[model samples]
Target: MGIRTLVAMLAVALVVIGALATQESYKVFMPGLLQGAVLTIEIAVLGSLLAIVMGVLAALARMYGPAPLRWLATVYVEIFRGTSALVQLFWLFFVLPQFGVMLDAFLVAVLALGLNVGAYGSEVVRGAIQSVARGQWEASTALNMSRPQMLRRIILPQAFVAMIPPWGNLFIELLKSTALVSLITLSDLAFKAQQMNQNTFKTIPIFTLVLLMYLAMSLVVTIGMRLLERRASLGLARGKAA
Candidate 1:
C-alpha cells in the first residue's frame, strides 16, 4: 500500500509539472490573487472562531437558560439562519451607516460571515449537547456538582468531541462563503480570481487554479479537523476510563 501510494503521488507530481511546464504564466497572476487567498484564510479562521463561540453561547441559552434568554436565542438563530447570507452581508456593508451603526467593509464581512454561520452552528451545538446521555446529567447531580460546573467539566467536553466533525463541515462552508465578500468589495479568493480573469482574459486557467486553491485549503481544514477529532476522542476515552 505504501509503494502504491508513493507511485500515485509521483504520477500526480509529474502531471502537475507537465502542466506548469506548458503554462509558466501561472506565476504572473499569482501574486495579487494569492494576497486575496491569504485574506480569505484570515477571514475564515477568525469567522470560524467567532462562530464557534456564538454557537456555544446560543446553544447553552436555548437549552438551559431562563425563558427570556431562551426566547432571545431562538429568535437570533431563526433570523440569521433563515435570511440569505448575501443579503445579510449587503445590509451590514451598505445599510448600517444610515442607522448610525457603521462598520468598515472588512469588519462587516467578518461579522456577517461569523454571525451567519454561527446561526447554523447553534443547531449543531444544540444537537450535540442533547445527544449526551441522561445518566451523565444525573451522575453529575448526584456528585453535588453545580450546573455550571457539570457543563464545564463533563457535558461540554463530551459534546464538543461529538461536535467536531459537524463543526468541520461548517468551517468549510464558512470558508467557501467568504467568496461572497467580493460582492461587497472585500478582496477574497473568488474576488481575486475574478480580477485575474478580467486582467488576463484567461478565464479557464484562472478559475482552474482557483478550484485547485480551494481544494488545497479544504484539504488543510479537513486534516486539521481530523487531528482535532482524534485528540478529542482520546480525551473523551480517558475521561470515561477514569
Candidate 2:
C-alpha cells in the first residue's frame, strides 16, 4: 500500500485500540475525568481574568506612555514571551519562597500563566487600539476633547470592539496553557490525569478521558467566542446602519 494509505490505516488501528482501552476502564476513569474538567475550568477562568487585566494595562502603557514607561512595558513583554513557561512556573513556585514570599501552587500557576499570556495578549490589544482610525483622534481633538475624554468616549469603545476577537483567541490559548500548572502540583486537569494514571496504572484510559474532557471544554469556549463575535459584529453593523 501507499504511504498515505498506510498512515490512514495506522490511525484507524490506533483509534480502535483507544476505543477498546477506554471501554475497559470507563468506571474508574469517569470520576477523575469530571474532577479534572472542573479544575481546568477553574484555572482557565481565573487565569483569563488576570490575563485580560494585565494585557490591557500593558498595552495602554506601551501605547500611550513616555519613552521610559514604554521601554519598561516592552521589556516586560519580551522577558515573559522569551522564556519557556515551564521555567517561569518553576521559578515562581520555588524561588519566591527564598524571599519570604510564599504563594500557593495554584496562585503561582495563575500568576505565571496570566503574566505569560498577558505579554502576547498585550500585542493584540495594542494592535486593536492602533487600528482605530487616526481621523477619529483628529476629530476628537477638533472637538476640544481632552485625552481622557477622547479615550473614554471615542477611542476605547472602538478599540474594545476590535479587541474582542483577538481576546477570544488569547483566552482559548490561556485555557490550554493552564495544563502547565500541573507541573507545580496544582491539581488541575493534567495533574489529576497524572494522579489517576499513577494510582490506577491505567495510563491509556485516563489520558483518553482527559483528552476528551479538554476537547469538550475547548469546543464550548470556541462556540461561546463565535457567538460573542457575531453579537459584537452585529451591534457594530446596526450602529453604522443607524
Candidate 3:
C-alpha cells in the first residue's frame, strides 16, 4: 500500500483502540478538541493560500524578474528556508512587538507558517517550471510570445500538474506545523490536548486522541490534493487536444 493508505489505516486503527481504551474520557475531551480543530483548519487553509501566493511570486521573481527582484526573492527564500521554523515563530510573535509591530496571534501564526513553507515551495515551483521541455520554450519563442504570455498560456498549465503533488506535501507539512501556534497562545488542537491533559492527567488518552485527530486532518488534505491533481491532469489533456 501507498504511504497515504498506510497512514490512514494506522490512524483509524489507533482511533478504534483509543475508543476502546478510554470510552468515558473521550466524552469529556472530544468537545474541546473539536473546537480547537476548527481553529486549526482555519489557520491551515489561510496559511496554505498565502504559501501558494508567495511561492509563485518568489519563483517568478527568481526566474524572470529584474535583478533587484531576483536578489530579494533569493534572499527571502534562503533566510526562511535556512532558519528554524520555531525561531521564526518566536521572532514574529515575541520579537516583533518590541519593534512596535504588534500582530494578532492568529495572524502571526499564519504568517510564520506560510512564509516558512513558501520558501521551500519556491524551489518546488522553480523546478516544475524548469521541468517543462526546452522545445516548448523554443516553440513559444517561434510564435514571438512574451514571457508572461507563454507562461500563462502554455508553460504554467503544464507545470501546474507537476506542482500539485509537491504542493500537496507542503500543505500537509503546513497542517502539522499548526501545532506550533499553541506556543504563541493560539488555542489550537495541540493546545487543547495539553490543557485537558494538565487538568485531568489523562496523558495517554488525550495525546492518542490528538494524534488521531491530526492524522484525520492530514488524510483529508491528502484526498483533496489527489482530487485536484486528477482534475488538473484532465484539464491539461483537454487543452492539448484543443
lDDT of 1: 0.84
The per-prediction tally of clashing pairs is 0, 0, 0
lDDT of 3 by residue, 67-174 (tens): 999999999999999998889999999999999999999999999999999999999999999999899999999999998899999899899989998999999999
lDDT of 2 by residue, 160-220 (tens): 7777767878888888988988888777889888888888888877776677666656656
Best by lDDT: 3
User: Which lDDT tens digits does candidate 1 get at residues 38-57?
Assistant: 99999999999889989989
Off by over 4 Å in 2: 1-24, 237-242
From the highest TM-score down, the ranking of the candidates is: 3, 1, 2
Instruction: Give each prediction's root-mean-square deviation over alpha carbons.
Output: 4.0, 6.7, 3.4
TM-score of 3: 0.91
TM accuracy, model 1:
0.89
Give the Cα lDDT of each candidate: 0.84, 0.79, 0.89
lDDT of model 2, residue 88: 90
Q: Model 1, which residues run further than 4 Å from truth?
A: 1-22, 235-242
